[model samples]
Target: MSVRPVVRQLFRIEQLVDMLLALTGKEISRLQQILRSGTVVYHYYRYWWEGFEAVTEDLQVLLAKFPDADPSQAFRAEQCTAAAIEQAETQAPAKKMEVEIPREAASRKRLLRARSLWECLMQLAHENIPAYKTYSYGRHADIYVWEILPDVRGRLEKAVERFAPRELRAPLRRILQSSGALRLRFFVPR
Candidate 1:
């Protein structure tokens, strides 16, 4: 439970993004174990916060590249209609059912959007956000992530609403809002 292993695992961009985007109950429980096992270093907390900020900023840039109208809407509407038709067909006795495989951005436009988003996300590993210096130092204290990074949660919401793909909007919000990641904040004392 040393700080180095914890930092290497948690502060990594790909791992962090995956944690944010695909957090599970099991993962949260594990993260809780990590948090409760060790005293979190102050500088590491700043690094962790900056990781989240980088994820959000990179997503914003990718989303800005999307066309004004979200291409996913049309596909979503088609899917709903297809589901209704399928449900009606299912009610009829003894029909052979055809399985529908979902495509993640099958069309060229969608593929492009997806690719750009991927690129932005990959770039997060290399990007750095300059941390502002804080002169005041106090006794070690545990602080809520939202409390210390006040406006960041709000910014994350705005980015999701404005730029996130239609499918990702809900899960991203739910996971980040309720996951163990938010509980990882620390206020380091010198």
Candidate 2:
């Protein structure tokens, strides 16, 4: 089935965040700050990698559905774009030399940290969970409805209908109990 592009992008970002956490054992607050500001260089690199994967997957699915079509022709435009990005990444210096060694060294240090973060995410994704499960989180208690039922959207709609501002806490608890949404529980102590 074709996934929505926005959902795919959100899933990729979630994966990137998970990878960052696994790699550095960094605080969630710091990661949230990085995502919020969109300033970190590594975030750009990770997003590029995820975008490449999404495009590649889209190409694969389209080709599978239409084997006779020249998929390469469709993908040529993206291929060119990917090539340009690769070239830019390769030519870009870790830091400009005119500043000083310390600043340049710091940039190199951050880049290395980002690489390690990416590696950890890859390792986690490969080890214990299916690719789709990589995007799952505890806060989204409604995810269980999607997992268990065929009519996920319908179930979510019903839940939203029954939802009330005052009754939220108890209803959420009941839903969690009924759905077993907390099965893959992991504790991250503050």
Best of the candidates, TM-score: 1
Residue-wise C-alpha lDDT for candidate 2, range 32-149, written one tens digit per residue? 4555554334432334231222244443443243212121221111111100000111233562111111111112223223332123222322343311112122221111101223
lDDT of 1: 0.31
Alpha-carbon lDDT of model 2? 0.28
**In model 2, which runs have C-alpha deviations exceeding 4 angstroms?**
1-11, 22-24, 43-190
Looking at model 2, which ten-residue stretch has the lowest summed lDDT? 78-87
lDDT of 1 by residue, 54-74 (tens): 334454453343222222221
Give the distance in Å from residue 64's predicted Cα in candidate 1 to where it truly belongs.
46
TM-score of 1: 0.22
Against the hidden reference, what TM-scores do the models get? 0.22, 0.18
